[model samples]
Target: MSNKIAILLATYNGEYHLREQLQSILYQTHSDWHLFIRDDGSTDGTLDIIKDYASRIANITIVDNAGEYTGSAAGNFFKLLHFSDYEGFDYISLSDQDDVWAPNKLQAALAYLSLDRAGGYSSNLISYDNAMMRTSYIDKSQAQKNFDYFFQGGSAGCTYVFTREACLLIQRKTVNITTYKGRSHDWLIYAICRANDIPWVLDRQAYIFYRQHANNVWGAKSAFSGLVSKFKILRSGWYRDNVIWVAENSGADVKGVEVFERVKRNKLVDKFYLLTIVSQLRRSKRECNLLVLILLFLF
Candidate 1:
């Protein structure tokens, strides 16, 4: 028997490129998949396109968001995760409304993920500009290092596929989270995997064309270009706060839950002591390592 897969997609004003993306999914070589979509209050013809596809596609299902826009893409995806029916599914994958997927994307992910006891899988992505021209490939190789998971550098939620068990863990644990508090859904998921010591695979294959456009909540940023943004996060101490946020929201079984609590409750003077000793605080890429270290020391 073939494995059942659920593809969770969140859309907002995506009418222009949504059809191409839907067509790519329709053409997937792996056929035993169902699409579960939630529209975050699209004002344009995005819903019309989705309705058209739903009219013809038996596996397509849509969830109503009560006509309110989820302020962020992360929030929208989290909403889908919160509301989607998870039964009878062996795997769950995320999708972006504008990116065209490779026909074997799901197959390749399952191949690597099924070989081991991995709880989830993420892959590299081939990037494209607005004109459909190839831009570059996002690398997930160096990101395989354990510490790199905390940095949120190369991870994209659209490339993530979770085993049923992992999805269950998330659904059960995060059910009580009333708000993400600007936490990125992808980064939070990665952090949860790390905190639980859940084995995950980072595939080197680029199986999705990650689209870059002006409306993108977070655009592709090269190593050098991302430094300033990293500085601001460190300077504002949002990174540290987010670490605690993820730990708290990931439920009782997450490893280092106590440490996050301690950090969250610690005085300013104590933050310096705890951050320097805990290597997890230095979760930046090699290029920004020194900067992160310095900021942690001074902040």
Candidate 2:
């Protein structure tokens, strides 16, 4: 039997590019998929567009709590995971409202997952800027580190595909999360899978066109600008807090978790201690060095 995929899409005021995104999904080479969308109280014609598609597409479904407001994108996706009949499908994938997927995206992801016998899969993406008529390849498929998920996500959530077992694991792990603490769902999912020893494949292949726009929740930025933004986030203490939150919620057993807890106290000794083991914290060497600087001076 063919693998059946359930695509979870969370939308809010996405009428502008919703049609393109939906059409891209329809054009997928792997056609045995069902799209389950949950609109987070869209004020625009997003709902109208979704309804029109649902009326024509036999497998497209608007999930329950269609009009309810889920304050953030992560919250909306959490609701989708909680309420959707995800177990009915063989695999689960996530979709952003504006990205255009490659025709063989789903097929390629499943092929990788099955061949590797992995629980989850994510890949690099091409970030496209329409106004600038420019595109940049965003490489998230760097070498994996021991505790990297505690600091960063595996890849963009829009490129995520997981086996049914992986989806169930995520749902169970996140079921009791009362507060997101401003953490992205993708990051949390990656952390959970890694924490629990589930094998994840990070394919060094671009399968999605990640749209960049002013309204994007977290659009791709230039390398220098991205580092600066991360610095600001680190200075705000939100990054540390999220690390601790993820560690506790995901039951991470790494020694770095304890080190991070001490680092959170903001003591000189604790901060210095983290620098010694910084290599295990991030996937890229540049980020590892950057984290060292942040700890030495900023923290």
Candidate 3:
């Protein structure tokens, strides 16, 4: 028997580009795949499109949310993770309703996903504007070490595929309420994988056309804009709060917990204290974004 793949898709008010994305999935080269989608109280025509597709495809399953809204995409995705038919698949994937997947997306992800260990596979994505015109490719390779996963914003959930062990690790460790509320679903997964020493395979190939629009909950921004945003977040202290939340809820190792405890102390009263904290956490010595390095000082 062939291995089964479960593609988890979460949507809310995504009627505009939902059909195009669904069509792209139909063109995938991988044939042994099932789509499990949950509509989080979409008041638009999103359900109609989903119904149309489900009526035609036997492998597609419309997961019931009991008409309750999940508030955010991250929450909806987490709900999907909790409600998924765990024993029915070999591997799991995340998908956004607006992105158009390449024909080889699943094939490439499966190639890199190793079943022997708890690990994840993610790839770069070719970003597209609202008009569906290509803009630039988003590189998710900056995460060179476990520490990098916390310091930098990396891949979106839509680009990830995880083995059963990896998925189980996340499912078993996360405190569904606080974990999903404080961090994005993908970030939670990355942190949990790192905590347990699971390898993350980040491919450089762009496997999907990631759509960016005004309604995007977290859209791509320029480097300068990202820096400004980070600075603002640090100033407000939400970054520090979120980091601590993730570290505690994702079951990070002793050292991981120790470093974050230093952040929780909020002892950055001087340059000396800042240097001490950065030196303690920068164990990997891996190259990271300069802005991220600066933000580390803030915590």
Candidate 4:
């Protein structure tokens, strides 16, 4: 089997953090990898930094994201995602422009993907914490406290990796869609894994020291705001997609919209979630004000 990987990066004006992020990938425990980058019309020196890396690094390839064919940022992201189908790679990592990965990041995630399950390699998600981060738009308490438990969500875009099965599904679905001002990709993928019953892992260690700079699309919100935004993210593109709408999904496809209507008609998880929210709200009120605010902040 080919132990090859393509690190697909989606970039736009990421000059400042790009170098550090790239360096982290280079410092991986396993080096049999190719770095593929696409620039989304960056006026900043982001493209220059990529050029510098490509010049020095033999495996790296830089492509211009003309922002012409794809109508939006999500489309831009998908453009890079179609790497393996066109380029022929065994695995692809959805690399963010900002986070600093731990040296073992690739090793751990790729190792998991390479494992033999049953007969063939099944798609799995390995998400780790971006331990160190500073955010402007995201509510600090809500965003910061994510994943106290291991692999809480599917995986953050900052350090998400995909196996061939998942990549092929993504291509078939054409999932590079922007919703909620492009803050929707992470949740959408989570819903995808959930609906398809895809197995995933939430790695406890901090694989990437995620930096929460101002340019991040959206993150860090009070639990209420976070959930609301996520719901919107799910609902916007979610209203028309045909994917099954399980508890975790936003119901974007036709079936998804149907699921939402059915849920609304029958009152399913909505009441259950509302009840949980109410209980939590009561519990928070009994706790200290600061603590309650933090809990709410992370909601």
Taking the tens digit of each residue's C-alpha lDDT, what string does model 4 give over 74-116?
Answer: 5556777664474466666767788777888777766665562
Report the alpha-carbon TM-score of model 3 versus the true structure.
0.87
TM-score of 4: 0.65
Against the hidden reference, what TM-scores do the models get?
0.85, 0.94, 0.87, 0.65
In model 4, the runs with Cα more than 4 Å from the true position are: 67-73, 83-88, 114-153, 175-183, 221-259, 262-299
Flag regions of model 2 displaced more than 4 Å.
223-228, 253-257
Task: Return whichever of 1 and 2 wins on TM-score.
Answer: 2
- State the number of backbone clashes in model 4: 19
lDDT (10s digit) by residue, model 1, range 221-272: 5557567766676788787666566666664224654455556666665555
Model 3 C-alpha lDDT per residue in residues 1-299, reported as the tens digit of each score: 25578899999999999999998888889888999999999989999999999999998999999876768888899888888547867888899999999998998778766442436877888887856454997777543554655544347889988876677777777534643544577777877777678787777788898888878877675568766876787778776677676777666635465556555675644334545445333323433234336555654
Which segments of candidate 3 are over 4 A away from where they belong?
115-118, 130-134, 175-182, 222-231, 253-255, 269-293, 296-298
Instruction: List candidate 1 segments past 4 Å from native.
Output: 131-134, 143-150, 222-234, 251-254, 257-294, 297-299
| lDDT (tens digit, per residue) of candidate 2 on 1-299 | 36999999999999999999999999999999999999988899999999999999999999978456767899888888888546568989999999999999999999999999898899999999889789999888888988888788989999999878877888888887775537788888888888888999999999999999888888797678767887788789787777777777676735456765765586887877777788988988888997888777765
Collision pairs in model 1: none
lDDT of each: 0.76, 0.86, 0.74, 0.54
Each model's backbone clash number? 0, 0, 0, 19
Ranking by lDDT: 2, 1, 3, 4
